[model samples]
Target: MKKIAFATCVHLGLSCIEEIYRIGGSLDLLITLKDEKAKDKSGRIYLDEIANEHDIPLLKIDNINDQEVLSSLKEYQIDWLFIIGWSQIAKKDVLEAPTLGCIGMHPTLLPIGRGRAAIPWAIIKGLKETGVTMFKLDEGVDTGDIIGQGVIKLDQNTTATELYKKVDDMHIALIAKYWHDIVSNNVILTKQSSADATEWPGRKPEDGEILSSMTMDETDKLVRAVTHPYPGAYYKEKERTIRIWSAKTDENDGEIKLSDGYLIPIDYEIEGNYGR
Candidate 1:
């Protein structure tokens, strides 16, 4: 059996963990964000539940650079590391710790969309097609060599929730297809083209702030791209911030139609301190 280390905190991470177990890979170590209570867009509990259920040793680390983290990883003698949906960008020592090196799953085709929130970035930027990438971990942010990839088409109505799930599904599929090569350390490597590379910074919850100056189409894309799991897009109204969970372009010449469909705050049951 092949021994692998897994790290993640998002729904995609959960899926990868589950698939790793299903495929009969030995997950010797499972690393994740410090918060196990964090929920995905679908409100699923963090990876702790899976870790406990699978009897995998779980490490909730805030910083992968800590000396203790590297020591713990060496103890496992792990064949490879999967850093999908993890919180921190791992440093050099962490990447080189594992015998076969660290691998990450980025939502966009690699050498492009190399920063945080690649899925949302693709949608907000009006990309027609985007894919998930599994690549070797390097010193830079998601600048790893390609191991495998899977593509998906994006339509105007493709919500962030939907795209996230799709990419994860493809991610798991590719892992299954390459399970043998991964465990045996026998696989072809493809170098990413730096000439075609473009990088974007990761987004914060406040980056979801929406403004009226944004085009109806732009606002629609922004709202849908950030909806669920991530902080919803919002604008200040009368000193209260109204975070939009959903929206669309209406038949009235692409006018922005708030999913709320009401002049007053409906609360939308989103996670916030505000009341209707």
Candidate 2:
């Protein structure tokens, strides 16, 4: 069996992890991080679960490039490394450690959205369609040779929560569909064009603030882009900060506008967990 290594976070990493196990390769090593905020009854990330069930070696780290991490990874003798939901950019030294180098599964089509919060950024920019890509990792942020890609359509109403799931499904599908072709060296690696490469920084909690001058359509997209699983877009009102879980651009929609401007939010009430 060809030995392989996996790197990713637990909660969001399942889309790739479960399938990797199911595909039946020599997943002898798994590297992950501890998420303090995301919890479950089992108190284990999927990485821990997979390691326990399959007897795979597991490494949890704060820095993927730390000397200590490098030391431990060397023991795996891995032929390939697949990084799914890892948040940091892999350093060149580490990226070169794997015999075949590392593969990063980006949620957006590369040479376009190549940074943190690809889903939200695409939606906020009013993109009609955005997709996923499997690429070979390089020193630069997401500037990798493309292995395969698939598209997902979006509209004015696409929310971060919904897109998150769709991206997860695509991750699973891409791996299933292309694992053989990728591993056997039967695939083509398309070089990314420097002229088309785009990179943006990750989003923070404060970055979701909506501006008062945006058009109704723009504000609506921003709200949906950051709703639910993500921190909702909001603006300060008097002494309180109000978070917008959902909004609409259509004039005929049931949302009653209390005020009007280029784009301004109105008051409304919501019920239930509302997709918490």
Predicted model with the maximum lDDT: 1
Q: What is the lDDT of residue 166 in candidate 2?
A: 92
List model 2 lDDT by residue over 105-206, tens digit each.
888888888878898898988889999998999987778899999899998678898998898788888888877776675768899998987886789978
Model 1 residue pairs with clashes:
41-229
Candidate 2 lDDT at 64 equals: 78
lDDT tens digits by residue: candidate 1, 186-238: 86779999999989788999988766566667777888888886787886655
Task: Give Cα-based local distance difference scores for all models.
Answer: 0.76, 0.75
Native-to-model Cα distance after best TM-score fit, residue 19 in candidate 1, in Å: 1.0
If candidate 2 were superposed on the true structure by all CA atoms, what would the RMSD be?
Answer: 4.9
List candidate 1 stretches off by more than 4 Å: 9-11, 32-62, 237-241, 250-276
